[model samples]
Target: MSRPERWIRLRGKPRGPRAFRRDLAETAPGLGAGDLTALLAADGDEILGWGLYHPSSQVAWRELRRGPEPPDEEWVRAAARAAAERRRRSPEIDERLCRVVHAEGDDLPALVVDRYGDLLAVELFSTAALPLARLALPELHEALGTRHHRLALDAAAARAEGEAAWVETSPGCPELVQVEEDGIRFEIDLRRGHKTGFFLDQRENRARLRRQVAAVEEAEVLDVCCYSGGFALAAAAAGAAAVTAVDLDEEALAMARRNANLNRSRSIRFVQADAFGYLRTLAANGRSFDFVVLDPPKFVPSRRERERGLARYHDLNKLALPLVRPGGLLLTCSCSGLLSALEFQERVRQAARRAGRTARLERLTGAGPDHPVRLDFPEGAYLKALWLRIT
Candidate 1:
């Protein structure tokens, strides 16, 4: 069936960075609340694009489809199927745990789907996508060959939209599921865990760490902010002599311990403490590691927090650099979309200088290919990792 073309007008010429939010001159009167609407220029009735109108949000409208053509159910289904096919074609992705859809990367805004074995976790970022997501679920199921799925809503977005945090579409779906990646097993609880149960974005990075650790016999490793022991277990399985995983969340530490036991990674030690304080104590005790990974949560969520967030990143790296022995490896990362890759690299350089160490950048990377970024949407490429060697 053809979708209805509900139209709304924009204030000025749409000549700027492509963003979810578009400035409005005026909206069509009597438009249904939160319905998908066609975006038109103020001068004429010509349809500019398609967007979701939410009067309550600061971004009154979120553009969904760009250009004249409006999107329909078939369009949404095709996008979802294409996203799934891309993952299937990528040899780097482990089918059991991979991102099935990366929202805007797939040209489907505000919708993300991650596959964990038979379970599919769907996250809706905008209210407009909620209806479209409902239409795409069956298509997603057919494309991914998974009937079991759950809607994992962002807590903040849920509150903003006046909806529940999470909802299960299928009955008898388990709270937790076991999945494997690169020969390592993990237990993921989609309902309670962060970002659809596991950090699938770091899958490749962890594999890289494993390979690097395997090259160094008896490598002592430290994983800061090690949620659920991804890097810790990877290093341990790679035959690291000792791996310490530190995080502030006790629950995460418990899960990390369980993951360690599940993988029989006895070399990892789980510690629940503030990463900064722990790093300070390690430095004071003159303790050092052959490899250190600093993967903190999003320090800069928005542009307003960039200045303070950069300072925090600088301070954290300053403390972390000293904990890496001479000739040792340091893998630091920032998930903040507001911090550019160049800015993050410069901060790390300053940190290295303050630590009185000369560092060589071995590699600069980001999330796995599963989390693909659209060239036009740089914000999608939020994860920045710098692999350095300190001397």
Candidate 2:
């Protein structure tokens, strides 16, 4: 089949880097365009760079490789080599927890790469980056000189980008590796674990937990819904006498146990139970903690799920408030973009009231600096961290 074509025009703005768009004219042969609500480069064209276009997504296009000419096989090979070389240079991106390709950051639009020990995970969002990944990943393997690679797809980005359904995970490679976060070390298992094998985004939050725990001598700590034992590890490091982490996922609890061992400490306890169930149990047992960290996964996935998610959040906190000692701390976090900061705050307030407790806001925060939000895209501001003092 003959491919349709379109010229990509570059639009430069004063505030930031320029954007690439479809010009519709100066067409090229054997290049299919337009039928795709989004456009992904299929053939060669004498353009400024190798572009991957997605008209359907919030981000229309991303220029992967920059040049005044079309990207050839040699260009793809060199890109593969350079990406591997860049990954090799970073002490963080070794056989442990590290992000390899971060979409626009790595010059691959809508693509994410994670390194899990000897395993490599790749997530493709754009159609152009998808097929291109299928082609270039082999080259990436050759460049890395490794036979084992695990390509995991993040379907969330694909759905948001308006692409067709894609498979999720592939074969596994390794079991465990030592990972460091904010000077704290953790043991992570890539084969059966969470995103890229660990939640690296919570690095800053863990540091905050450590700081808070250190302020209270031998404070009893509760790390609720603690995935991989991040906050618990931080609390233990901060000199907390006893730290209890609760999560339903057995795999996560296993890794958390390993992470605790890596810290050369066994002062923390792990419980594989539902978050809300454990919270209610603690309340029933008349147990109170000096610090509680409520870091749950995305409860609100879409607009329709917002109301129910908010109710759930409130209910969870309502049960948790009584478990917090008076004048103690409660660190609550919501990564759901659908749950705005104001909405989350209101829910927490309602929870405190229901528990017959008075709470004061101590701090408010968001994701780390690496996950930058665009000026216009407020929805990009997903993670909301709230520190509260219950009295």
Candidate 3:
């Protein structure tokens, strides 16, 4: 059945591709809940795009498609197919585990799809994309060659849309699935894991760390906030003399230990403690590492949290800097979308000054190639990692 369309007129000059939230002058009269509205120009009836109207959300309308034509299941399927094809063509992407659809990167706003071996994990960032995601799933399965799937709603989207946050689409799917990346093995818990079972975006970064450490024998390593020990395992596999992985989550520590055992990486010591306090203890103990990785969770979730987030980043780096031996490598990362790469680098500079050390930036990078960014939307490039060498 064809979907019904409602019309809404914009108030001012047309904004380029954007997420609309109460910026419009007027909405269609008598537009009820669940109406999929087409945005029109203020002066004429020329259609701009299609979006779903939610009266309760600050985002009054969440755009789904851009152009004059109305949106349908076929359009959704085409987007899924295109996203899959792009990933297939990327040499850096491992077909067994990688991102297939990266929300706005694929021009399919608010929907992300990742492949974990035979299992597919889907995430909806907004309620507006829920119906479209459901329509696109069959095509996604065909393109990615997977029938096992899981759907998860962004926590904020769940509250805004008033719907369940998670659902398992395929029965008989295993709770834990093992995936291999760059000759390293990991067991991901699809039902209860961070961001689509694993942090596949850092796949390349971990490999880079391994390659760098492989050249140095008996290198001491530290992985702060290392959920499931991705970097810890990589460093250990590269023949690090000793590796310490720290996180507050006991469940994650347990999994990290299990992963180390799985890979026969006995050098890693899993520690359950707050990262900040642990870093302080390491400094007070006069312990230093040849290499350190700081991959903390998102501190600045929204624009309002920017100031406090920068302070936290500054303090973390200040404590982390003294622990890096002279000429050692420090891989610091920030996943906060509100924090730009320039701002992050500035904060690190401030930390180095406070630590009375000079540092040179070796490399600056973001997520793996699978997580492509749109030219118009720089916010899509959220993950920032700086490889710094202390002097």
Candidate 4:
């Protein structure tokens, strides 16, 4: 992207550049970029940074780099190497599978890097991340020592640019690449799954759930929307007496079944059904569980859908809470970045009240250490999880 450097003045952002989509809703002074190319070359007078400049995107100019020194090929190489080295050394992160670069969290915005066995599945969340990816991927590949690189673009972000949603430039990933992350064995199809194939973000949470399951005797664990059986398999691995995993997607259930088989977990009963309907049926049949996990997909992707999404969460949790036996544990989660921790907890509190259950809030966790968040980018702190106990 050989484009002319544009100089712009930004104010009120003492922490860093405003890059998140949520920032767009604020009446805060907005900065517009020229339609020169996908990759942006710009100067904040003193700050020299490179970002993705999109005309139609929610955050049109999403800055990826910001520093006193101008970012270049060599600079990106060093940054990528450092980011990879950090993950490699983190005890919390599994070398077999982990997030090396968490966009802005790693001081590299717009770009995302995930490791899947011998290959690195690199995806640009938006075309805005492309400029940095172009400069960083080759260097990142060398740092990670991967056999191959699988490049993919975010379809939703691409569509905003009036481009095809699914765009891949590299070779397909190995089928069912097995990853033993955080002491749990998961066989995943990097080419077929969502967000670099597996939910590496839930690594530590799953491990925590496994330990919790182990502490209880004959724990009847219920995993809702058990995609590929991440949580269900974890519970089963911990020797839970009975584990019930449910999902609406047949393909996901099929994968979950395969994962159960791979883990040699025969205790889990896999069911393909609507999550709400299944929860309702479980409650109707008077079935209760020692531990229940509610990890649904993103409901509030943007500010416009905030209230509607919150209602969905409230309804889902209201139905699921009753199935949580008295004194049992419940883990509810929301991937919607727009829903703050306070907002999520309040919704759960409301749900518990509506369900006529006295729930004690035990913990509020988030994506594992692998998915780090920058202090300024509260939006980066997307995943909100609540650990509660029915009293």
Highest-scoring model, lDDT = 3
Residue 345, candidate 2: Cα error in Å is: 2.2
lDDT of 2: 0.69
Clash pairs, model 4 backbone: 52-128, 103-108
TM-score of each model, in listed order:
0.93, 0.71, 0.94, 0.89
Report the C-alpha lDDT of model 1 over 308-375, residue by residue, as the tens digit. 99999999999999999999999999999778899999999999999999999999999988888877
Ranking by TM-score: 3, 1, 4, 2
What overall lDDT, based on C-alpha atoms, would model 1 receive against the true structure? 0.83
**TM-score of decoy 2:** 0.71
Q: Count clashing residue pairs per candidate.
A: 1, 3, 0, 2
Tens digits of per-residue lDDT for model 3, 23-102: 67777677754467887777777787887776655556656678777777787788888888888888767877999889
lDDT of 3 at 388: 97
lDDT of 2 by residue, 1-391 (tens): 2222544433332112223333332233333322121122334333444465555554444555554455555665566566667766755434244555555554545556665545566766555566556656777667665555655555666677565544444454555666577667877665577666777567678888898889998899999888888899889988999999999988888888877887886889899899888888888888999999999989897776888998889998898889889899999989896678999999999999989999999899876543445553345567898899999
Which model, 3 or 4, shows the larger lDDT? 3
By lDDT, rank the candidates, best first: 3, 1, 4, 2
Flag the better candidate by lDDT, 1 or 2. Answer: 1
Model 4 quality (TM-score): 0.89
> Which residue pairs clash within candidate 1?
11-25
Against the correct fold, how does model 3 do in TM-score?
A: 0.94
* Greater-lDDT candidate between 1 and 4: 1
